[model samples]
Target: MERGIIKIENGEIIIPDTPVWMTVGEMSDLFMVSAYGIRKALRQIFRSGIMDEHDAVRPFPYAEGCYAEAYNMEAVVAVTFRINAAACRRFRELMLRRFMEKSLDFYICIPAADCNHRTGYDAAQVWQERHKLS
Candidate 1:
């Protein structure tokens, strides 16, 4: 089996929104490591706050809202950033591959006409102004 993160392009991966949350199995497969190790690394990353916003990684109902687990895209990225040293080239490579696949293609379009304030500007433009994306 392909032990790697199921990217958005794969269509089988769970991505309810733009952040791209992945399950422990997906992360473990992506990193080619045990789920326990991913959890350990996540615990450390959570304390850092650079990735995890809260004390515990937010739980997401992935499997048809029947189950929930610590599923945060930012947390995964943060954990990868910390341990992606020379010793973990494979991890870095996987990250690169995932990113290189045009993950940003999944864009959220909010019609400007629907908003009362903005008439001509698209949601993406407003987002750029607020977050300085451009």
Candidate 2:
């Protein structure tokens, strides 16, 4: 199977508008690991019950007469966490950073009046100061 292209910019991974489903070979290329390594990680991921094989993987027609096993985004993330490689580390870090940013954004959007008074701290000010937002 041909490897799908993964784009990264300014240390952030860029996902395509359309959902991507990649075969083991494609994931190996994208993660800069051997196909065997990907399979190994997938085995562990499934064995640990982190993801269900039926939900995470599906067979897709890659050629006129052949079908290959392809993994969805959730499976891809699970595999990334299991793999030990520079690409995997970078992916994990970027995903965590994005999650934290989103959480902070949500918190900051809440008005100071809505913030919990029990903490005796203003959540909005704290977030703005920490993020260096004027």
User: Which one is best on lDDT?
Assistant: 2
Which regions of candidate 1 are displaced past 4 Å? 1-5, 8-18, 53-56, 62-65, 84-88, 91-134
* Residue 121 displacement in candidate 1 (angstroms): 35
TM-score of each: 0.46, 0.68
Error of 1 at 99 (Å): 7.2
Per-residue lDDT for 54-116 in model 2, tens only?
998888886799988989888888889888899989988898888778845333265767566
Q: Per-residue alpha-carbon lDDT of model 1 for 1-134, expressed as tens digits?
A: 11123443442333343555667777776656677877777777766665545633446654575754655656666666665544235545666776799657576666655544556556656676888754
lDDT of 2: 0.81
Model 2, position 125, has a per-residue lDDT of 76
Candidate 1 versus the native: TM-score? 0.46
**Residue-level lDDT for 100 in candidate 1:** 91
Per-prediction tally of clashes: 4, 0
